[model samples]
Target: MTLRIHFTGEDLARTHIAPQPDVLWETMLSLYRLRRREQTLVFGEWKKTALGRVPGSVRMLTTLVPVRGYTVDFLTPRAEPGSVAGGMEALRRTTGERLRGDMAELLARHPGKRLPGWAERLAAGCPDALDALVGAVDGYFHACLSPYWPHVRAQVDRERARRARLLSAGGWEAVFSTLHPSARWSFPVLELSYPADHDIHLGGRGLLLQPSFFCRQTPITLRDPHLPPILVYPIEHDLDWARGQAPDRRTTLTGLLGATRTRVLETLAEGDCTTTELARRLGVPPSTASRQATTLREAGLVNSHRLGQAVLHTITDLGVAVLGGRWSGLIA
Candidate 1:
């Protein structure tokens, strides 16, 4: 089965990449992966840990996300650059009407199925059901992903930067060609090998290319074609990438850079932030924060961009590498 996306001139013009991972989407996909036990090499440990941490009540939430089948669309909100908490907040706010409609659609797609009790409650717009579902998701994330989020974000950022560079050098052609092995670009049509066969005509709505850390092999698209078009593809990573070892050399880096600068780098790895925000987060003087950022920027470990009156500092690829204790160059 293949998904062929027909693109127009406007579609080509509007097609763009997302700057960060969609937390809700990732969480939903991770649950699917854990249920399917797919990519055991990468997710085995995480799956074990997540399942162990999942409460008895929350275990029912897994039934909603089958190994292969329709999962509700509202489970994942639109992609935005930020923490998973923001995504959870969106999930919590899903309107009862929309939830019921999506749940109805899910059940309708799979005929002769008995709806899980929790799902039934959720579809009925029960507040308790919503809270329970959200709690389960949060518990799963804390158990499985929070510990490794820094490493995950680093890899995602590096991939985004690489693709951005590709876009700059050769436009969309280079990007599409290098996107993934499963995605084939032929003229105005982009063919994606999917579980279901369908054609999505991007009637000038374009598409959003989102790289996912948990998505493996096959890329996923939004089931509702009428909604915004999005393609969630797996980001490439080595075996050790999932293992997430920062090396023993971090102690040396900490000693050299002092605790405050090291904390700044660690915090920046989560996401970009202004110097003032960084200072407030770390409880340091704004001048001290500025000096540290300047030092890190001069070292080529961090990059700062002026966004209006505030300058946002983000960890560069080298910076991520250094945080992993892989960089052996001079600390000064």
Candidate 2:
């Protein structure tokens, strides 16, 4: 089975690469990976730790995300590029009409497949059902994803940087040509090997390319094409990424700039990011991160710019030089 995506010249020009992973999508797919025994080799430690700690409230999520086939579209809304809380809020506010329609389609497609009571209540727009579902998603993230998110995020940032370099050096054709082995770019069409045979005519809506640490083997797309077209493909990882943690290699830099400031600089070096994202990555208070970033900007080691609601920070050439040859060799 193959998914043939028809692209226009406008589509090519409009295509976007997400700066970070979608929290809801990543949590939903990670659950799918957890349920499968075949993923043991890839997520061994995570599975071992997460299985025993699965909260009773979130256990019902197992019913919603099956090991195979479709999951409800409302669970992973792509309204905007925002935090996990924003995504969950969107899920909670899924219109009754939309929820029921999606559920009806799911039932019709699967014939006699059994759905949990929560699914029925959710379809009917019960408030408690929505709360319970949101709780489950939150609890699941706390149990399985939060502990290792920094490491996962770092790997994702690395992949994004690599792709950005590709885009700069060789244009869209080069980027698409090496996107993934399963994805083939041949002129006006981009072909993806998938579990179902389908075609999407991106009538100038363009496509969003997202890299994921959990997505493996095949790229995934939303069932409905009318929604913004997004392709979530796996990012390559090494043994360190698989270990679910990043080593503390900033000791030398920490000596130069206090620990917190060094961390701020290191995080900025990964890629351009918002103050909020920097704080989250460093596990520091947002105000503290902002202060540190301001200090760096004043010293001419970082540059800050505003894009909509976000204040993005990027390392300056002097900042890279300050990181010196040793740190450069380590990340390289």
The best candidate in terms of TM-score: 2
Q: Write the per-residue lDDT of candidate 2 for residues 260-305, one digit (tens) a residue.
A: 8887887877776788989899998889989999999998777775
Q: What is the overall TM-score of model 1 with all chains considered together?
A: 0.71
lDDT of 2: 0.76
Candidate 1 lDDT by residue in tens digits, 216-317: 878888787887898888875533454555334476878978898899988877756788989998899988988999999998777775544666676665
- Quantify all predictions' global Cα lDDT against the true fold: 0.76, 0.76
In model 2, the Cα lDDT at residue 140 comes to 87
TM-score of each: 0.71, 0.73
Query: RMSD, model 2, all Cα superposed?
Result: 11.9
